[model samples]
Target: MKTKICGLKSLREIEIVNKYTPDYVGFVFAGEKRKIDEEVAQTLRRELSRDIKAVGVFVNEPLERIAKMCEKNIIQLVQLHGDEDRDYINALQSEVEAPIIKVIRVQSVNQIKEALTLPCDYFLYDTYSQHSYGGEGKRFDEMILTEVYKEDLSQVREGLQKPYFIAGGLTAQSISLLDNRLKPFGVDVSSGVEISGQKDEEKVREFLLAASKVS
Candidate 1:
């Protein structure tokens, strides 16, 4: 399984990720906390390792703005975390070639089923919250996964055709707790690897090590 360390800011954090690179690192372009401006993102992107991909997290951001970021090669992937519909995605696709990751705040199995129909390259399943778009560090009910796949924790199923990443309340131990049968394409972590609102190097390393053991 792949590992994505999200909500990374500052050159110090970038240095940490460079040393122990995750498959992907995220820069928050939306929200108040953890959000970075275009200039700052560009600077950090320049320092980031080429081996690791950078993801730009946004919530209902302007298409031109996101497209521009991709055009500038500041972020390798776009993660939509708001109420953006197909038209918005279709329009954005016309402007940029970067792959889009639609985040589905899982509330019910039906919601996941519906999201599968969207025309995005990947999906990220995060816990639903009333107050925030993401980075809440709360795990959704795993029973939902069992219902969607309709299989035992040790059996694989082809129900979800698209590759996806799981987010929310994920830590090193929590990742180990994931049903080996229900493997996500990747695992996304933010607050889970943080210490007092900052990225912790030891925590990030531990999280990556745990993910490496999966699959």
Candidate 2:
């Protein structure tokens, strides 16, 4: 499985990931404590190695703004974590070259079914929170994801498997528990690698090392 480190802030944190060189890193543009503006994200993007892609997390942000960011290549991927509809996504996809990853705060298998209709380059399964959008550091049942995977594949779609990443409260140990029967595209973690409310280099390395062992 691949690895994506989300909610990265500060040049120091960026430097750490640059050294480790994960598949993707995230810059939250939403109204969260970890959120970063366009300028800051741009600067950090410049500092980031070309091999490591940047993902911008947004919640109900304007379509034009997101398109512009992708156009400028500040973020290679857009992770929509809001109530954006198909029309909004279609408009953004039509206008931008960057791939989109729709985040579904899953509470059950029903939510996954609802998300399948949505067009996106990839899907992210995160823990649902009634009080917040995401980054709650909570994890949903992995068994539910296994079922969703089976359900998606049962349709006999063109693809053998639907690409997706599992987020929320993910730790190195938990990543190992991912059923070998279902292979997700990647794993996203934020608070799991944090220490004292910030990204800890040791924890980051440990998480990546642990994830690398997963098939």
Candidate 3:
């Protein structure tokens, strides 16, 4: 499975990821704690390895602002982590060419099913939290995946059509617990690889190694 190391902020963090090199690195443009401004994001993106793609995480941000960020090549992918509907996604798509990853705060199988109908390039299934948009480090119920399949195992099943990343409270041990039937396209990590609220190089290295072992 692919690995995405999200919530990167400083130049040192950029250097660490460049060396360890997860498939993708995320810059939080939404939340307060790990949030980075446009200038900082641009600087970090430039220092990032060309092999790794940068993803911008947002929570109900203005369409124009997001489009501008993409236009400047600060982030290759956009991850929506809020109450953005199909109309907002459609409008955003019309403005930028960057691929969008709509985050489905998985409260139920129905939410995942509904999100599949949206016109985005990818899906990121994260644990739902009323207090925060994401980076909560809490996993959602894995049983929901089984429920989705039981509900509709059809060829036209929209949920299975698109690729998705799984996030929230993920670690090397927790990743091993993932059901084989619910094969995610990739895995996203934030606090799991952190130490004292900062990205730990060893933890990032260990997580990446673990992810590599996953089929």
Number of backbone collisions per candidate, in order?
A: 0, 0, 1
In candidate 1, what residue range of length 10 has the lowest lDDT sum? 150-159
Q: How does each model score on lDDT? A: 0.88, 0.86, 0.89
lDDT preference between candidates 1 and 3, better one: 3
What TM-score would you give candidate 3 relative to the actual structure?
0.96
Each prediction's TM-score against the native?
0.94, 0.94, 0.96
Which candidate comes out best when scored by lDDT?
A: 3
lDDT of 3 by residue, 18-37 (tens): 99989999999987889999
lDDT preference between candidates 1 and 2, better one: 1
Residue lDDT tens for model 2, 168-190: 89897788877788778999999
Candidate 2: stretches off by over 4 Å: 152-160
Q: Please, what are the lDDT tens digits per residue for candidate 1 over residues 1-215?
A: 88899988899999999999899999999887799999999999999999999999999999999999998999999999999888999999999899999998988877766676688888898999999898489999877765776533222233266688999899999898886667689999999889998999999999999899988
Where is model 3 poorest over a 10-residue stretch in terms of lDDT?
149-158
